[model samples]
Target: MTTSAELLAAYDRQLRTDAETPSALDVEQLGPLRLVTFDGGRGFITYAGLDGADAGTIAGWVAGALGYFRNNPAIRHIEWKSRGHDWAPGLHVALVGNGFEPEESESIMIGRAADLAVDVPLPVGVALRQVTEEEDVRAMSAMADGVFGDPVSTATADSLLRRLSHADGMELWVAECGAEIVSAGRLEPVTGTDFAGIWGGATLQAWRGRGIYRALTAARARSALAMGKTLIHSDSTPYSRPILERSGFVKVSTTTPYIWRAPA
Candidate 1:
């Protein structure tokens, strides 16, 4: 029975920093922000907490942060990750003023891995397994993109393949019906932490309510436990938040990503 406050404290102290960006190609510090450059021309902005900055100061940071990324011609898109619990004033105004558009906020769910490692009955003809081959990884990414209603992009697949080369303890799992991937997600085991993150979970619309997602989650939780991880965390969308809540995950906080795209 971990309180939300305790889970959130662990999330901020243990899960933030470079551990949150294991695949980053470059990381630069901008005041209190971590300006991360990743492959596929992506930039990311994240910080553990804003040290009680006023509105005007945050606005200046916003402008300066965007300027830092704008200098890199290779960077075409950026995402600023904001947590609901932070005490930064005028963050919304500052981000929007700098051309960042808000995306949907997700529940920051956290709980013990053992709680989610229980057996979930899978539908017949569907199976879950960890994947590693290049072909399998690409297929899993494409399927997840399609399930999430995004036009499939090779950049996403390419990034995953590159991460695989690092052997970064990232495990890809999928639920397949014969040859088609119906559900998919990835488990990221952070170094020097007691937490494992279940991320990028998505399932086909037709496969909804079939318990496939739960089974897939359970499988990842079991893998986390096997890796000696004590806690499981996910930034869950509305579609998956309920499922996690049903499994005893507490909503410790919320997170929203404000994205900016360079003009083509």
Candidate 2:
């Protein structure tokens, strides 16, 4: 039996670097932090467990990470992705004291691909499929943004399109009801690892409880299994965590994203 500690250990070892920054154009290292510059002026800050760093050392890293990104004029939006199980107890104060606002925390869900690959009955009139065309990709992004209450992001769609063009093992799946996308998610197979992640899962309010999202998850899991991935991972919101939990996924940890936006 795989324990939560072991699962989190694998995640911290295998997923904290390249697996976390697939779209990064440049990455700067500040102490233990990886300050990443992605396309479209987005910056991201993350790291593996802080190890044994004390509050003062952790505080210095926080300040240095901010300065590293703010110096780049193209960096308009920054996010510090913090894990719940890390030993950096002073991260919250250091980040908030430095003007970063914390977003809602999400559970770090980990499970076996076979557990979630089992058949899940979809609702009548709903069909799931992988999308690659520009029109379909754009529509899926729009529906997911609306479901998550975020402004529609064309940059996200563009990134996905670029990945598809590169033949990157990233799959976007959507559940459609009469030509309208009601639920959507992404499956990314990490090269050289046993893990493939299901990310950005969302469902329309009216479509909730109809099994569309669960069916979409199973479809993604089946796709992951076909890609030779035996493990599944996700950072899922509360709305989606229960569904994943029901399918035998366990919460290995939690993650909270603290965000900073440049002033107009």
Candidate 3:
């Protein structure tokens, strides 16, 4: 059994390499900031967990990354993801000075995959499985959008379509009540690494407290174990943090996303 620290260490080691990017708009280095391109008209910036930097350097990085995005008309917005454990100086001020606004912060949770594999009770008739078909993938993405309080986005659906084509051991799992998806998440078994990322977990408000999310998490864990992954990590919202803690995941740090929205 891998400890949470060991699990997180493995994740950090792999994320900087194999898990960093998969497309043109993924993760790019512009001086100090890690520039990322998402499916929509958005770009993003994150660091490799830098511990500390002076205010001047931090400010320069923010300005430089913003300049890069401004030069590219393809990017309409950017999000700077900051880790709570990082000791970088003046990050908050720098982001704001350059027009980035802080959004809600989330807990960075990590744990051993086996910890979540314990048998969990599920609502009768609810089942889970990996999705591959285009229509089903689109439906799941739409359900997730609804759960996340975002409007339906064709870009998300299109990206999922492309992701399925590559396969690459990435699998989308959903908890279905009858024919409707009540909860959905993704399993990313990073190649040549001992970690698998459990991402985008969203359960409908009405479905809360029913253990559907845990069951879905377990299903992903079981799959990860089969694929030789020993660890699981997620940047969790407050709503999901307690549930994950009960299931043995520990809060290692917090992450705050700062956004620069293009003028509408």
Best by lDDT: 1
Instruction: Give me the runs in candidate 1 sitting further than 4 Å from their true place.
Output: none
RMSD of each: 0.9, 1.2, 2.1
What's the distance in Å from true for residue 45, model 3?
1.7
Query: 1-264, model 1: which lDDT tens digit per residue?
Result: 489999998999998888999999999997889999999999999998878889998999999999999999999999999999999899999999899999999999999998899888988999998888989989999998888789998999999999988999999999999998999999998889999999999999999999999999999999999999999999999999999999889999999999999999
CA-lDDT, candidates in order: 0.93, 0.90, 0.81
Residue pairs in clash, model 2 = none
Model 2 lDDT tens row, 1-264: 389999998898889978888767998888778889987888999987687899999999999888888899998899999988888968899999888999999999999999998788988888999999999999999998898788999988887888889887899999999999999999999988889999988889998998888889999999999999999999998888999899889999999999999998
Give the runs in model 3 whose Cα sits over 4 Å from its true position.
1-11, 23-27
Give the per-residue lDDT digits (tens) of candidate 3, residues 1-264. 346566556556676552645543466676656788776677877666654678898888889889988887878878887877677888899899999999889988888888898778988888887888988899899999999889998899898788777766778999998999999999888777677888889898888899999889999999999999887778898888887898788877788989998888
**What residue runs in model 2 are displaced by over 4 Å at the alpha carbon?**
none
Give one clash count per candidate, in the order shown.
0, 0, 1
Give Cα distance to truth, residue 114, candidate 1, Å.
0.3
lDDT of 3: 0.81
